[model samples]
Target: MRRSRFAASVTSLLLATGLALTGAATAQASSTAATGGYVALGDSYSSGVGSGSYISSSGSCDRSTKAFPYLWNAAHSPSSFAFNACSGATTDDVLAGQLGSLNSSTALVSISIGGNDAGFADIMTTCVLSSDSSCVSKINNAKAYVDSTLPGKLDTVYNAISAKAPSARVVVLGYPRFYLLGQSCLGLSDTKRSAINSAADYIDAAIQKRALDHDFVFGDVRSPFSSHEICSGDSWLHSVNWLDIGESYHPTAAGQSGGYLPVFTANAS
Candidate 1:
């Protein structure tokens, strides 16, 4: 009887141990499954236009492994990653082409947009080619558009993103001031540079308002890029890469790694 009782006790202990191990395994599997899915959607900035080393498969989207999205995904190991950002994409482009990648299963979404919608390229060209007064006038025109027409357009895009990825944490990344306030380079005078920076601020403010309205996160990159503006000696943004005109005025690899990535990761919850 004593031997039988001892055997039964040992059997019970073994069974409890087995259950504990199984529970541990189940917990681990659950943790892995809960890591979340990330999707990046936006325009040239998000696609890493100036960072170079584009992913061939991404084509005109010009996605680079060095882009913040890829870097973030590599570090976090999201369950899935979809890079849908394209070069020269406007708000309409995002609605038409990029929104398809987002769905209820998407856990995180990051975007840098609205610059093109404000005709940033045209403004830059005008500034480069025209007088300071003309540039200031053009910048004022863009700001007026941002204050008037842009709010409605941004609302539409933000609303659609919210609808498509209802459960995901959406982060709206803003553009950096391309030039330092008082410094001038690349034929841009201090006045023109200040105007351009002001335009960027206007764009960021509009984006921030939209993000707040939709209860989404706004990743402000101005602080990170403060010391790295184009006129700075240690700038992280490209200053008129004539050989790669498409890459001109965009963030460098250092900008993507040190500027965008940190702001994105910190606000990516």
Candidate 2:
């Protein structure tokens, strides 16, 4: 009986130690995964367009302290951080400009691109100012570009990223749907709003496909921004502001924190 008791005690102690060790290992690994150099790349969405409080040093690129990349770096204290994303950046722009600052030391990267490539500004301008038929035509043109040419452009950028940051975990983020469908929005009619949302979905789908093809994580923000889209009572996005035309149709700071940041945090590994 004495021997059996001693054996049982030893077994329990071993199990406890093993569980503790496993937990420690998990914590350490998570820390390690999030600790290396973080490089932010791509366009205005990543650079914080409507979020405001832009980094003065960033000039026209409009990097914001409120941006998800800046917020994540602030929270995690990565060994190094390079905010290379710019406003008005297309796939070609990223390919030419943003590929710097990525290296083997980079443990994580996040990007939001392909919107400008698909003529985001043009579509918005047409939708807001032109007839509903014109808006639909513009959206259809954008969709065609997304379906045809954007894939190759995205592939080029993704390939360059892989080459530049050979070991980094890449997270490719998608834009939020512009409007809450079935809700009463002021500017655009439901037809226009629905078409715009459909365009957003198309862009996101294209981005996701290429991200997956490159073995990168696709961070979809639509789900997070669902009830909080522009037409929602609690909207996270900015509708057209004639005062600051540049800030039109972009995520507000809340969208960055409550939407994009959380999605990135969940998928940063």
Candidate 3:
């Protein structure tokens, strides 16, 4: 059986037998339902590694305490949440790993992925510092991959999620800008930033298209963050791009709060 189909069966069985139980908890935000539940899934950006403190099982990916799930949970109180947003997740992770525990009662889902597939982070690590003649080529390669691959991945993810929980409202999250367009720094350059953001725009556009195709909602976070670079005053994401070493591509605590909260709240209805 397909993984999504099997999970759906399990969910049906649980709901029928009343065997699968969720512990009741209350968040400070407004209660949206008699019982609220969510299953968050995605890559490092979803995990909050570069943004803040780690929370889930410590793999190199470093899921964070201040990730979007936390923000959403805070906004919607008295909800059950299963945050399986491991670092470095791809579309396959959502279809297989994230949906395995899903059920009909699941109210919402949010995802942020495909950065790894397009090699966005790798592009930064490789071309951001090295003044190589091939830097532009590498950026171009990342863009090409994202443009070609993201739509299919979106289809697969949306299909799998909808199959598992037909009633759940799916929200696909987009990557935030990691570079300052037309600006340069010590280790990173504006060119690389522009390239990455351009690639992100492609991915986000693909996500929005998929959302429309599948009747799911797409959250476009790029414009609201136009002037807000990573290290800028009250930025929504972390300053990983400017950092000389360590993880340099994730949201900051404030970034998640400022950028993520509005979307989560808007979509909850």
Model 3 sits at a Cα RMSD from the real structure of 12.3
lDDT of 3 by residue, 125-218 (tens): 4554456545677777876776787778878878888888787777777766666655444444666566666667777776678787998777
- Superpose all Cα atoms of candidate 1 onto the true structure and report the RMSD in Å to 1 decimal: 21.2
Candidate 2, 1-269: lDDT as tens digits:
01122233434433555520112212322254456899999898899888889999998788999988888887777899899999888888888888889998899999999988888877776676579999999999999999889999999999999998888999999988989888766778999999999998998999999999999999998998989988898988887544455776788888888888888877886
Give the alpha-carbon lDDT of every model.
0.79, 0.81, 0.63
**Mind sharing the TM-score for model 1?**
0.86
For model 2, the superposed segments whose C-alpha errors exceed 4 Å read 1-33
Give the alpha carbon lDDT tens digit for every residue of 1-269 in model 1: 01122233434433555520112211222122136678899988899888988999998788988888877776677788898988888888889999987888888999998888787876776676679999899889998899898888888888998898888888899999999766545567888888989899889999999888889889999998988998788898876564565677789888988888888877776
> What TM-score does prediction 3 earn?
0.79
- Against the true structure, whose lDDT is highest? 2
Which regions of candidate 3 deviate over 4 angstroms? 1-34, 56-61, 240-246
Clashing pairs in 3: 27-78, 51-251, 236-255, 237-252, 238-252, 240-248
Candidate whose TM-score is highest: 2
